[model samples]
Target: MTFARHCVFDGSSVGSEEWCASLDEKDKGDWSANEAADYAKYCVF
Candidate 1:
């Protein structure tokens, strides 16, 4: 949260319809394998 905000990292992918629909609070700070993949496509791609 803090790191991304300071760096201006957009989380649109993770929070988008496809990614966020599959997530819950359990997958917040500590990401599961699937979440990591989604984040990669959304935030890294």
Candidate 2:
């Protein structure tokens, strides 16, 4: 997804338990700032 698209959901890197916890849990390690778009697609899981 592009910056404009992903920005709609969450403009920046989603941390803590503020947004989708499922997506955070999906990542076994640090969620790459570059991988935010991939996480939005649920492909990272």
Candidate 3:
């Protein structure tokens, strides 16, 4: 969170959607993958 704010201060382009997708791609900092997996499992019921 601190690093993200610094990156924005340093003239990096930042958007909520971009941040969300980047976090999703990394799959380390966020729980996107886990949530998706859970949803998929529930859909099978």
Candidate 4:
């Protein structure tokens, strides 16, 4: 249950919307609400 390879972190930050949306369904399914929030915070806005 690891998706670390699919993610891109800069220090304590994550990647962009294109990267977020690039995740496949299986990888995305493993995400928690907090992960989604982080993605929205860094990637969406």
Best by lDDT: 1
How well is each residue in 1-45 modelled by candidate 4, as lDDT tens digits?
A: 235544554333355545466543337778888777767676665
| Model 4 lDDT on a 0 to 1 scale | 0.58
lDDT of 1 by residue, 5-38 (tens): 7444644445465446456434577877877776
Model 2 segments more than 4 A misplaced: 1-23, 26-29, 43-45
Quantify all predictions' global Cα lDDT against the true fold. 0.59, 0.54, 0.50, 0.58
By lDDT, is 1 or 4 better?
1
lDDT at 30 for candidate 2? 64
Model 1: weakest 10-residue lDDT segment is: 6-15
TM-score of 4: 0.40
Worst 10 residues of 3 by lDDT: 11-20
Query: Which residue pairs in candidate 2 have backbone atoms (N, alpha carbon, C) closer than 3 angstroms, thus clashing?
Result: none
* Candidate 3 residue-wise lDDT, 1-45, digit = tens: 887677655442333345445545655545567555643454334
The alpha-carbon deviation from the true structure for residue 7 of candidate 1, after best TM-score superposition, in angstroms, is: 26
What is the overall TM-score of model 3 with all chains considered together? 0.28
Which candidate would rank higher by TM-score, 3 or 4? 4
**How many backbone clashes are present in model 4?**
0
Model 1 residue runs over 4 Å out of place are 1-29
Model 3 alpha-carbon drift over 4 Å, by segment: 1-15, 29-45
